[model samples]
Target: MPNKKLTDVEKLAIVQEIEGGHIGINAAVRKFGFSKSTLMKWRNRYRLYGMEGLAIRTCNRSYSAELKLQAVMDYFRGELSQYQIIDKYKISSRTQLADWIKKYNGHSSLRAYNGGKTAMTKGRSTTWQERLDIVLHCLANGQDYSQAADQFKVSYQQVYGWVKKYEAGGPEALRDGRGRKKAPEELTEADQQKLAMRKLEYEVERLRAENVFLKKLQEFQRGRR
Candidate 1:
């Protein structure tokens, strides 16, 4: 069902009906208004781990880098398919496993997954310069908003909004712009020097980001070949 949250009991009932031969997969799909893939997923999970497998995830699950590496190695061993690996590892989804495989094949580092629900309702205050830096950092690191937020100790929404604003209207758009800003000509020699130094620092950071992106791109290309 689209956007439907099926209770554990309901999910069990549906899987039982299908398993007991009371309802065929196609018939269940038609009656329950869920895709065949979803129904099959439920059935397989129920079969593999009983009720526990069918339980809805209340929070995001973290996988250790070691577990990810093992899963990747198992797949490469060719003894099990992706679905089999997922079931064996109790992974949350095919997509999650697929991501690991892709990263592994591309020779990217597989770090422990510690992501979920990091966005805040209220964002903290930031200066225009800080906003610009945050946006630049986010873009440099594959536009990972949550990572940028955590690193900068800002809200995810703030980082995201700043990036979008910067994208649409350059660095000037990041400025609060509500107050009068000093013109370039109005800056003292020391102020100008500081600005120049900051620009140089940002440029170095951007170059590093670009180098990392290029390396990742090359890795993926090599993987495809």
Candidate 2:
């Protein structure tokens, strides 16, 4: 934290040596807070555009949305694997890909939920930005989608779908849905009538949760009992 900075020359020297197999990526990582992903990122750029690619990243060239979207599309159409896209783009990690795919999907729709002036744009619609935030939070906090969904007040399916969209198109996947409402489940009137008497579903869920809490409480109480 001593205002350390790696210059272009230093990064190039370190990255070149790693790519050339002169020094281990792990060693560099431990010595300089580098990781395989960082090595991969530098290697990808160096391989594609050489030293020029690894030059100090600037907003002008580093966060190229167009380039990221293209990579997502390429990955989606089976034209390139995520690794290949990252490798070719000199991208260091999967976050950019996830973000791009989410964004790409959002823009493909004609509806407003696609993040523009359209019929589908209304309500507190979920967004790729939100989705990515949720996904990353879940990952960083070490929870799976189902658990994360419960905490986020979204469906597990929605979370999974977003994850899929991200994989397919990057962040664009999350943005594709503007503020569109979720279609109702395909239950007919008859089915609704038949199921109306079944308090078991809700009851079961409530009871299960209560049971878990009670079990934990009992454990704690036992210590004091």
Best by lDDT: 1
lDDT of 1 by residue, 53-168 (tens): 78997775777765676676678668999889988988877778888778766656566758423233236789887887788778867787767877887755577778887787
User: How well is each residue in 128-178 modelled by candidate 2, as lDDT tens digits?
Assistant: 557866655454444356455656656444665666665665543466656
Backbone clash pairs for candidate 1 read: none
C-alpha lDDT of candidate 1 relative to the true structure: 0.77
Q: Which sections of candidate 1 miss by over 4 Å? A: 114-225
lDDT against the true structure, per candidate, is 0.77, 0.59
State each model's C-alpha RMSD to the native.
Answer: 13.2, 17.4
Cα error, candidate 2, residue 142 (Å): 47
Local error of candidate 1 at residue 102 (angstroms) = 2.2
Question: If scored against the real structure, what TM-score would every candidate get?
Answer: 0.45, 0.40
lDDT of 2: 0.59
